[model samples]
Target: MDVFRSMQIMVRAIELGNLSAAARELGVTQPTVSKIIAALERDLAVRLIERTTTKFTPTEAGQRFYERAKQILEEYADARADACGLSAQVAGLLRVNAPLGLGEMHLHRITQCFVRLHPKVEVELVLNDRFVDLVEEGVDLAIRLGGALPASAVARDLATSERFFVASPDYLAQHGAIEHIDDLQRHEFIRFAWLESGATVEVAGPDGSRHIALRGRYSINSALSIRQSVCDGWGIAMTPAWLVQDLLDDGTLVRILPRWQAAAQTLRLVYPSRRYQPMRARAFMDYLESEIEAVPGLTTSRPRC
Candidate 1:
């Protein structure tokens, strides 16, 4: 028998002055209440109540037990309230995981603001290109850039990343500007090795859309490395605009096809789904959503060719 439940039913029966009323309050049948009362009496080896037809009254000993049981239930409620409050409070170490380049480029700024807004939270950001098991690694949150989610992954998309065809002015000056989409084939291409099968860039013209394969002379795995290579006059590459926004503004890098771009990336805030997320993680996720919009070229529509 559930001791607490038995005690609660006895207490409610005494207060309501009727077994039927107590059963109604508890959302249980009258017979169920009678069974609990009987079990509780057997467990205590004492008759707890005097019953007559539709009315009930607690015995002297039952009065004492009822008072004590009420206190126990109140204490339990208080403890639960405290536990829920602590679970929702933002005051603990928040371990976060994210891809290297995106973390360094954008997330750090938003996190900096989030910590300032919530000083009690201590953040540990682990930046890596490889995927980490959120449960095994004990990560509160992860920001994944343009990647497929696992079968069991739970994620909230925060923003879309725009990929721009960027190259340094020096390289364009040397090789000459690409006058048309076909001109991209005549030039050596800098590729991000992680792209794998997606070496082709889909472009839209007055006629329709087609994929232009980047004939790679150089390939890099890191977004930062790819941006560096493009800036260093290695070759043209499709890079996330936020990663090279300053370069684009300063003309160190120029957007090759203003009208055309590769597919936009879906940036997601990922986490393991089991229980309610910690307050710090939830707070940071909300903060990042608002701050990410400020990144240049993130919402800017493509220009006409």
Candidate 2:
């Protein structure tokens, strides 16, 4: 068996999630893909994947191999590009993952400009609220928002987003104004469910470093859904200012406790730590950092140590 070719096939199979899909991607038949994986497993003396009739899932070893294979492939590609004097050209597919709301609101314009600047680079953006494993997902970069990131990834702060407690005028009219954090318990709150443990909203007021215990009548994982629910007067919500800045300016949404500020969230451009960062990735990050700084009220200052 050609070990390198089989390894490539195995990587494709894991990424595509099925032999048929891998076959299509590799321009081969399903049996050919299966045979390649079978040979690869035999050569490695380990079961790389667990397969059922309807689905295929990688084993822990398989996941590790997949990540390593991606790094190896990226290094090989970079070396080949350098040999061919294509390193400066920046031509290839660049995969990015970002939160759905932010991607829709900001990334599209950045992507347009990026493509215009590097005409040869093809971009694929996956927008989801879920945090994805960059290496396993084969993502080139991820745009993340919130507090401190995992130490495993290299992060660069792109912008700072202030958090605000907002509710529609209609909701406030019915529920009365929430003048204090204690009042939040009496009111129905729309919570962003994905803000998991270790996350706290720091509100400045009479009680310094006050962290409110969040209780919600309705919980959603999507920022877009949370915004819509808040706009429709479902309940008071704490969200990034950028998501509701227009509504606040237009009198559709009212900011509660404007005097008691909530901790700000930072937008970060993150990628897996590697020995070598590709020129395309570096250039894209540089462009994004520049563009994001130009936005009003958003600053790119380094976060306090």
Candidate 3:
């Protein structure tokens, strides 16, 4: 039995929760995977996995072995990379995750440019509004828009983006004008379905900061949907500047309570670990930092020495 190959197979099977998925990912047959696991169990004289009709789970010993095997695989890969001078090479599959709206507006184009620059690099861009586990999902890097992050994640602040309370010109014309922060109480507020700042918003102005309770008839989960709703003259919304900069420039959307603005949001590049970062991931981060300056409302937040 090839112990190294068995370790690799077992680790993948556990991570994916089944042998079939592991076989598909590793490009091996299901029977081959089963045989390897059986061989491993026979060699160790212990049952490594427990199976049921629904799923497969690791035994107590199997769980411990899986953890150690995963570490061994990672260390082996790192060692091989270093020995082969692969650390400096940018040829590999890179999985990236980003918020849906931001990914559609920016990261898609950014990824295109990156792949074009380094033809050997293959990128998979996953766009979603939900939280992701970087290691479990096999994501190399994630572009996060808010400050809150998982404790296990290592983040590098990418930029700071301004947020604004905005409405369409037609909406303003129909609903009248907002002169004071309290005046917002009388107008419709388009609620963004977010974990942070759900029912209330804090804005800063010359008079200082005020926390206002949001009252709205319509609530949407997507940034693009909120922008469209506000653009259609539904209500006013507090939005990240990057999402509406173009509309603002074209007069499709106008900033309300122009003197008052919400707290700036920090964009972050998040990864699973600080140790053993691949060359491709580092290259992508550097490329994004270089291009961030040209994006409106986004200012670099790189720490200065």
Candidate 4:
């Protein structure tokens, strides 16, 4: 038995929470993954995984071993990279995760260009709107859009984002224009269901700041859907500048509060904290930075220290 291969399989299975997912990631049959895991358990003489009909979980011992195994794998990757002169070459599978709207807009292009530059590298992009744990999901990195992140997360700021309230021209024409912040309450609102904000929204305008308590009939989780609704004249919605810039220019959506500013967000690249880093992941991040800087809205023209 190849102990190294089995360890890799065992670690993937635990991280993915299923044998089939691990197999798919590793490009092997499900039975092959199961067989390797069984051999690993037999050799270790411990029950590492607790399987059930609904789900699979790692035992306490399994959790401890999994953490250590991940460390070992990282260290091995670094050492092998240096030994094989792979420090200059990026050749490996790179799995990336990001929000659906952002991914659809630019991440595919980013990955495509990176692959073109490094033909030896394989890329996987998973666009999801829900929160994902990088370690548990076996993700190499994630593109996150938020104001602040967890204290323990390792992240790099890629750009600054500004949010704006927008609506279709026909909707605003029919519903009456919002002359002041107080007028927002009178208009129909489209709310993002996953957003933690309460029913009320506080806005900062040219004159001052005020709060508007909204009673939106439409609530959705997807930014794409919200943009569509706003374009279709459903209601006024708020979104980042990057996601709706095209719509704004093409006259599909119009900015509602030009003087009133919404919350700003930071575009970030987040990863699980670790002592050693993978060469491929690092290379890809560098490539991404270069690619993002060229895009007009993704990043600013200012230099970083």
* Model 3 spans with C-alpha error above 4 angstroms: 14-18, 24-27, 41-50, 56-87, 194-196, 302-305
Candidate of highest TM-score = 3
Candidate 1 per-residue lDDT, tens place, 65-150, comes to: 77567557645654664677754446656778988888887778778888888768899989988888775455768888777786
Candidate 4 total steric clashes:
0
The candidate maximizing lDDT is 3
My TM-score estimates for the predictions, one after another, are: 0.68, 0.81, 0.86, 0.85
Range of the 10 consecutive residues with the lowest summed lDDT in candidate 2 = 296-305
Error of 3 at 207 (Å): 1.2
Which portions of model 1 show Cα errors greater than 4 Å? Answer: 1-88, 300-305
The local lDDT score (0 to 100) that residue 2 gets in candidate 3 is: 94
lDDT of 2 at 240: 85
Candidate 2 lDDT, 190-273, residue by residue in tens? 877766642346688766878777666688888889889999989888888778887888898999988777778788899988
lDDT of 4 by residue, 61-167 (tens): 88877877876886788788889887677787788999898888878888898899987889899998766777666688899988466564699888877776888
107 Cα displacement, candidate 4 (Å) = 1.5
